[model samples]
Target: MAILFSRRKITAWCVAALASLAACGAFVPAHAENLDAPLVLVVGYAPGGSTDRMARLIAERLSPKLGVPVTVENRPGEGGRLAAKQIKRAPAGENVLMLGNPAVMVVAPLVFKDLGYDPDKDFVPVSQVSSYDFALAVGNKLQLDRAMFLVGRLWAHPEEAVFGVPATGSLPHFFGLMVGDALSVQPQIKGYGGSAPLAADLSGGSLPIAIDTMDSLYAQHVAGKIRILAVSGKKRASFAPNVPTFREAGMKIDADGWNTFFAPSTMPQPKVQLLATKIREVMQDPGLQKAADALYITPVVSTAAETAQMLKAYRQQWEPVVRRSGFAP
Candidate 1:
């Protein structure tokens, strides 16, 4: 025979379960437990990409800690806007999170007229997972070692102003335009579907120069398939210390890009704090750090307050440049 609980008994049981989780600094929605809503990490890019790989890494270590089933969902489209939208519509108290980058969280709002959702109002920053800098790579056909040389070449040959960017409003795109302005040449940037194709073009001499995240081009650069002329950062990347920075090359262009984990706005503050703390713990794993290092990205763990400050800093640094570029939706 099956035993049934009265409404009062069920309510008391639910409250007791929540209290037990809170006593240990853990959080799991009682309703989610009742409905069996598994913890889901969302990646707003294709499978096998950097964001997807990072999401998988987080899920692997986070599942056992959270004591729940975890999975990664790829919702690729609109340069991460699709995944952001999905997170917006997620029900209150559901365990759905997304890996957010500047494209969706920072630049899109600065560029798009109708972004459909406000990142700050619709989502909550859990924790930052990694950081990287932008880089410019030259095809095998070009024999250049420093950014100044390419600047001179573009100044003399405006026809070679053609370049590649991973996405239209990405940090790389803006950084490419900034470099073009510094070169005083009319830059023609060709946006590709992803970094693989962009790197392929750079390798085959089909594209003379490309601007993208250092992580996006690290493999080909290490393989000696393409030459990264200058990195756009305050200093050279830690993984590629031999490479010179744009400032070191005397071009004065600098930028920093980062990736953070975010959840829907409806998630409770306690839940958000618990999640961010857990992510910080997961980021400390030696295996995770090793994997990130192999990809040429520096793994960083930041609190939600720190993440907000980073987004603000990037916006302030890029807004003037973007407005000066006169790029529109």
Candidate 2:
């Protein structure tokens, strides 16, 4: 005997069948299963900068592991405020992240009055990728072999020992102030447009001494054009192992710059966990480690919770130092 079915009955049967398949883990919604959406790693700097380079590297290694395309998008402006704002407003998905440093994540809040995004409220910590320390370097033209000699010169002739920083309210500027305080000399910080011009002047003897990242000054130091007196971390940088840290030089100060990954605060916890795990795995890749080493950056893999703790501790450590600097943006 043949049976005839109404449209309602046919629809009900189809729904039941689909439910049974889903229960057996044999079915998934089309949108949920589609993982082809491209992931974007946003950088707040122009292309070819260190942050941009790191973002591209992570994207290259992460794409294959996640089975989707991953790319870096630069949104440089207002010292990374623009990029942070965009990340805060990114759609509710796991398709976007940002490579941020202390400047954007920690310092900008204290410095800028009307920052578009609040670091604590607008973003979730994903992971910390790498970190480096600043170096107190002097031009070779100064002919100073010891860091103490530079201190003595500053103490005797404070007017002649002007310090150059890449920009105002930058890590270098704050670190310079700390160094000056440690030496008991009020720092005279001159902020240049960028590091290149500062490097040029430092090498030419016009800028006697300067504070910048080891990554920025290591090549010049290696070329015997500049003398790196000390680094501003608890441990010496791998790239400049011979240089002593500020503590070792009798300065009770420690400052290190770091890179972190952040997702919009609205992203789901499970999605955040998935992306953080993937990124931790990507950092473990041998090829990526080698590449990071070449850039003089140490590759670190951390959980979201760990990253949050680190961020908190970093803020606690730097808040006083920044406030003491009395920098108004």
lDDT of 2 by residue, 1-329 (tens): 99999999999999999998755545545435224378889999999877888888899988987788998999999888899988898767448999999999888898788998999999999999888889899997889877778878888998875789999889999888878778888888899988899999999988889998878888888898899998887898766689888888767888889999999987766567777888998888889888987887767888888999999999998889888777796
lDDT of 1 by residue, 1-329 (tens): 99998999999999999888755546655334222347889998889877888888888888877777789999999888988988998877588888989888878887889888899899988899988888888987898877788888888889989889976666788888888877678788789877888998889988889999998887898898999988887877778999998888888678888889998988767777777877888899999899888878788878888887887788888888888777776
Quote model 2's TM-score.
Answer: 0.87
lDDT of 1 at 10: 97
Q: How close is candidate 1 to the true structure, as a TM-score?
A: 0.84
* Cα distance off (Å), candidate 2, residue 243: 1.9
Error of 1 at 166 (Å): 3.0
Candidate 2 regions with alpha-carbon error over 4 angstroms = 1-36
Instruction: Compute the lDDT of residue 228 as modeled in candidate 2.
Output: 92
Q: Which candidate tops lDDT?
A: 2
